[model samples]
Target: MYIPSPFRDDDLENMRATIRCARLANLITATSGGPLATPLPLLLDESEGEHGTLYGHLAKRNPQWRIATIGDAMAIFTGPEAYVTPSWYSSKRQAEHVVPTWNYIAVHAHGPIEFFDDPDRLLEIVTRLTNIHETSRATPWAVSDAPVDFIAAQLREIVGVRIPITRVESKRKMSQNRPMPDRIGVATGLAASKLARDQEVAPLILVQD
Candidate 1:
């Protein structure tokens, strides 16, 4: 992540918040075949290590788990992102130098990757993951919702992942580089947008006030 000084986010809590909100992550690893990436839901355990630990699973048939990874694995998490038009920048009218850019939040975690197929651990990981995503629903589902034998059989088809995070890089590119007037223009413009992502980005920009 190329983060300018203005957009750099070093706050651990903020980075964790972004990861939590972004349920899914792009897990990438360098392999002999080339680079492989998989999109999966990862749970971050902030108390684990210097940075944190990531937990997730991949389908047993996914060759990524069986491949020999050369170096550290990277997990990318992205929050709300929106296209910012030149019309949203007040500077566009003043100097016409401002073009278009994007406003978004992203976090990257790097660490050695480990894959395991221990049934007990896999069971616990599956249970926790299920609860995290379903807890908000009226009829929340659980691993126990299904028969014990059925859940055990299902777990056999997946491999567990554990990455003890060594470092984290985060960026909150919400037009912090723009002047107050330009930022206000962006906030107002995004707030009025019919696109849900654009509207979600509005509050983040407004907080810069």
Candidate 2:
């Protein structure tokens, strides 16, 4: 991720928040054949390593794990984003110098990836994934809700993935490069948008650091 100085986000806590909030992520690996990517839900363990550890799984038949990887894997998590038009900038009215851009948050976690077939670890990953997404429900479901045999059968069809994050890169591009008036204009424009993501990005544009 090419992040300018103004947009660079070095805060580890903020990056963790983005990771936790992201509904899904793309796990990418470089293989001899090419690159293989899997979209999945991941659980982050902040206490695992210097950075963090990510847990997820892929279908047993998925070739990504069977094939040898060339280097460390990368997990990409994206947060709320919106399109910013030059029309939203007050400076554009005076000089028309501003162009359109995107305001968004992105995080990349890179580390060595290990794939395992251990049923115990697989069960743990899926159970935690389930609980995280189901906690808001009136009646949350659990892995114990299913018959042991059924879950055991299901677990056999997947391979567990673990990545102890070695490094991380992130950017929070919310018009921090813009002047106050231009940023306010961006906030007002985004706040007026009907898109939910745009609304979510509005306040971030004008955040004071």
Candidate 3:
């Protein structure tokens, strides 16, 4: 990723936060045939490695895992992203020098990829993944809520995935490079947008001079 200095994010905790908030990740691997990718939910275990470890699963039928991976795998997590119009920059009105750009948050985790099918490991991964999402529900569900045999049968159809993240790169491009007036204008413009993603980005770049 070609991250400009203003957009680079190096804080480990912040990067982890971005990963945790991301609903899904693209698991990509370089293969002899070609690069294969899978969109899946991944759990980050912050304590497992120097950076962290990722846990997820793919359907047994997914061929991406069946191929021989050449080297490191990469998991991409993207957060709130929105198109910024030139109209939002106060400087645009001054000299017409400003152009449109994007404001977004992204994190890339790179490491070795491991695939496993052990029923017990698969069961644990699914159960943990389920709890992470379900705990926020008003009426939360649990793996134990289903029949033991049914859960086991379902686990048999998927392969567990683990990646110990060795390197990570993160970027937070939220108009931080813009002057105070321009950034304020951007925040106000985004806040007025009806799109939820735009609204989410409003406060990220919001600052008081």
What CA RMSD would you report for each candidate?
1.0, 0.8, 1.4
* Whole-model Cα lDDT of every candidate shown, in order: 0.92, 0.94, 0.93
Cα displacement (Å) at residue 83, model 2: 0.5
Model 3, poorest ten-residue lDDT window? 200-209
RMSD of 2: 0.8
What does candidate 3's lDDT look like per residue over 1-209, in tens digits? 88989899998998999999999999999998889999999999988999989999999999998999999999999999999998988888778887899999999999999999999899889989999999999999999999999998998899999999999999899998999888988999999999999999999997421
**Each candidate structure's count of clashing pairs:** 0, 0, 0
Shift in Å, residue 160, candidate 2: 0.3
lDDT of 2 by residue, 43-124 (tens): 9988899898999999999989999989899999999999999898999878967789999999999999999999999999
Q: TM-score, each model?
A: 0.97, 0.98, 0.97
Q: After superposition, how far is residue 57 of candidate 1 from its true place, in Å?
A: 0.2
Model 1: residues with Cα > 4 Å off, grouped in runs: none
What's the lDDT for residue 42 in model 1? Answer: 96
Please give, for residues 1-209, the per-residue lDDT of candidate 1 as tens digits. Answer: 89889889898999999999997899999998899999999999888997889999999999998999999999999999999888988788778777899999999999999999999999999988899999999999888989999988988999999999999999999988889888899999999999999999998986752
